[model samples]
Target: ISRQKRTHKIILPCFIGGRSVSRAKSIVNKDGCYFDFPNDAIRILDAMTRSSRDERIVIGKPVLRKIPVGTKIQLPYHIVERNLHSVSIPIIKSNFIAPRQSTPKGLRFPLAAKAVVRSVVHKRSSGAVILDIASRGQLNDTLRRFSHMFARKLEGVYVQPMAKPGTELILGYVHDALMGDVYIAGIGGSFTEDVHDIGFYVGKPDLRGAKAMLAQLRHTSIITSIDVPFVAHQIVRLSRLIHRHPEIIELDLNPFIAYRRGGIAVDARIVTMQT
Candidate 1:
């Protein structure tokens, strides 16, 4: 394709061998100006092939194959004000508190209580699965069993109050063959297959791109029209979460509940895949 005809909005001083050479735009005209573009432009080219651009070239960063993993952090898009212990307590008291009035925190629920744990990511029956409490008795019985099975003291266990299900959003990053570092945004977990909401973008992630991608989703209503607080704000927050974490290989929030304008993740899991 003629460099002038290429509408990626990125321009390059045409290169000859290893040396950069300036090409006269008039010479290329409508005729194809075929030259090898840096490997970093592959994704841009692919996107263009799928859809033509009106701009010139898009300067893109080179991709590195072996990405090194560094510090890890779980950016809780939801549950900003509360902790795990807070949410789990109510669930324990209501479901398992058999001793009557209330159940002790560490000792577990009463005789008829159930044991509940919240997962960071949505995997129906995985190691990080969270259980529901029914009675105090069940809570106590299950606690011992869980401790024995895991062979570790359940110190981090927190009693929680059950909340209604909201929306699910997938946010993360992956190596892009063309655009170097790329961010991934999708909808997943129990309803991932059903929702089928996902989008990808090159270059540094920003609020503009994030909102644009969310608008493309079929269920954007959950974030725009939902009767929750911080609906749109959370989406922007999610974009910021991903933008801040460049080391994250993949981050999954099964159900990102849209609470007013801000949403909370009922469950979440993040995997760091660095070179």
Candidate 2:
């Protein structure tokens, strides 16, 4: 194929014997410049034939592979909260109590009675997830009823004070066999699927990386309402949790309520195996 004229942004500089291939890389003009491949024609043809395959074949990260497990246990929400708080991460105050009118100290009204279940993320068991308890009387009745109704299904009644309304998020990490620990941050809550955008960090996250993670979200109110540093710091801190607790295979903090000045992980699920 031949044409009278063709325009190019820049003719790619070539080197024959380590010399200036073109005058400052020939650029678009009235007439485009050309370079000669001064080599054996058979060799150039062979190289071109070999280069016909896909070039972008290799990527840097390790392949995601699931680890083989022996016996896994779903860590309770309170225990998860305690572990997270032990690392200076803020979590909503909660306690596991028997469902028999017993109360834990310093818990205020308008609480929630979340039944402890194994790896149940959503409202899989409708009645087990009860929220907005106005009084201790109501809480006790709800707990007792929950125990009676979902006896074998639940481990215990997890009571927590309702979190203040704010921007909700899902921040978590997964330690895989091949990929090691992959930290993630995203917009999540009841509206997780509504505008799903997640950012992943493979290495130890710094403030810059965490900021980029939060910036990838589509929700504008997340940036305007919550303290970005508070949330970004939360994401950066997950790297420590991964290192501190190697036994934890997966850690999920859903509905991470973010206020103007501070944020708290309202619910956490930590999956660990016996070590």
Candidate 3:
């Protein structure tokens, strides 16, 4: 169909014989030649078609693939934090106490009694599964058991002191085929899925832009009570990180606890093109 007439329809450009062409014609548009093919044959064409601007373009509907599991191993917390800093998000201060299997008897009791410790096993996209250690007596056993249970499916275990209670917020960026990189932020943590409250913006946002987006959330009151300017600055930094790192496809800072004094990322997950 002519470009003027086809403006309203979804236009999928196809490159044939080193030249671009429009293969399919609208049924209602009599100006272009239409071909009637069997349903099975049309399905084949649909499977092969790929779109430049459509993010969902694939040979067929995607399906889940099974991944092999392995034993969980602990990584140093400082190393983890250092690596995450490359992404421009603030990492919570933590320590890798001990592997679940080899917890020292003398250390476990003292670590749990005084400090509010949290055991976490990190995953690429799933973030970390956190378990709070109430008493020193339960630390060793709990870590060992939890490690064995999720070892095969997750990366490794690490322990850190829990952050102070504060307003939790989700900050992220996703690359869209048409829109490029998009920034997302909203109420996070346990309420992330339930609330589904979020705001989206195209490209990188400045401090003012970030604050404006934050102001759009339903729980703006909570966010405003804390350091709004600090959060906005972090959002802008995250956007810059996305722009600089094209390999990063998705990045999430969940439960980004915001206090009146400052903010800390309780948990973070990043998915790169290589992963």
Candidate 4:
């Protein structure tokens, strides 16, 4: 009689979405076991494996190439006139008050009556000096005290109306090599980092989808009471803007004030892929 060979069965763990599912049997032969993964699962697995190697990895998005040094790039945050022209959103009226320039005799204040002044040390880089001025007297007093100290190193002062108090949120997007475009939304302001209340959506989301995403937030009541439909519309608009402009690599609208009737972007920063 011939001797019989025994075969051992092997089980492999499978993953659906992100969580690991129950182990499935693999095709076992005399030589080895073979595990097969669905096409969608393969993509997810690839992303998970490569995540450690990259910093800005977004699943379904393509990988980004290294940026070269000394490139002439444009940043959206600066108060320069050239940079301001690129932004489409309505901005608070602002001006560059020249350094060491003589103030006009009996000149009216440039900003509104109740407006606040934020004096950013207008160099290529520096910190901001914020002052709440309800009248001309306070404005002159604040500037007289601090202007001389920052005059040489600073560029100019920027004055704008004080934004109304409201629920703050952040809206932005990043270009993923594999995903194309990924939109990010979350609670903003000082609580942004502390709370970590954020959500991500791949590609553009319609109004209905945007509403659903917002509904998932823990602070849904606060958001809805302020104005859910208006905010959702703005998200859709932002998504379309990102899709139309490939040159825009990143967009950050922080402290987006959402009120009972509407909303406004308090601060905006955009980065372009220009050389």
Best by TM-score: 2
Global lDDT scores for all candidate models:
0.40, 0.63, 0.54, 0.51
Candidate 1 weakest ten by summed lDDT: 57-66
Model 2 lDDT per residue over 1-275, tens place: 01232431212222232113234223311132222222222332344345444322111110111112333445434346556875788987776564342566567889977776544557424566777899878987887777787776555666788887888888988877787778888887766666777777777788998888788776666788889999889887776776776667788788798889998887887876534
Measured against the true structure, the TM-scores of the candidates, in listed sequence, are 0.45, 0.67, 0.59, 0.57
Task: List the candidate 2 regions with Cα displacement exceeding 4 Å.
Answer: 1-69, 104-106
List runs of model 1 lying over 4 Å from the truth: 1-122, 125-135, 141-159, 175-178, 184-186, 220-245, 273-275
Q: Scored by Cα lDDT, where does model 4 land?
A: 0.51
For candidate 2, what is the TM-score? 0.67
Q: How many residue pairs clash per model?
A: 52, 0, 0, 9
Supply the global lDDT for candidate 3: 0.54
RMSD of 1: 20.7
Local accuracy of candidate 1 as per-residue lDDT tens digits, 12-112: 32222321122442233223222222321343344445544332211111111121133222322112212222222111222222111233544432222
> For residues 120-197, could you state the per-residue lDDT of candidate 3 as single tens digits?
322322333435565655765656655565564333345555676898888888878799888988888878888989
lDDT at residue 80 of model 1 (Cα atoms): 23
Q: Which candidate achieves the best lDDT against the true structure?
A: 2
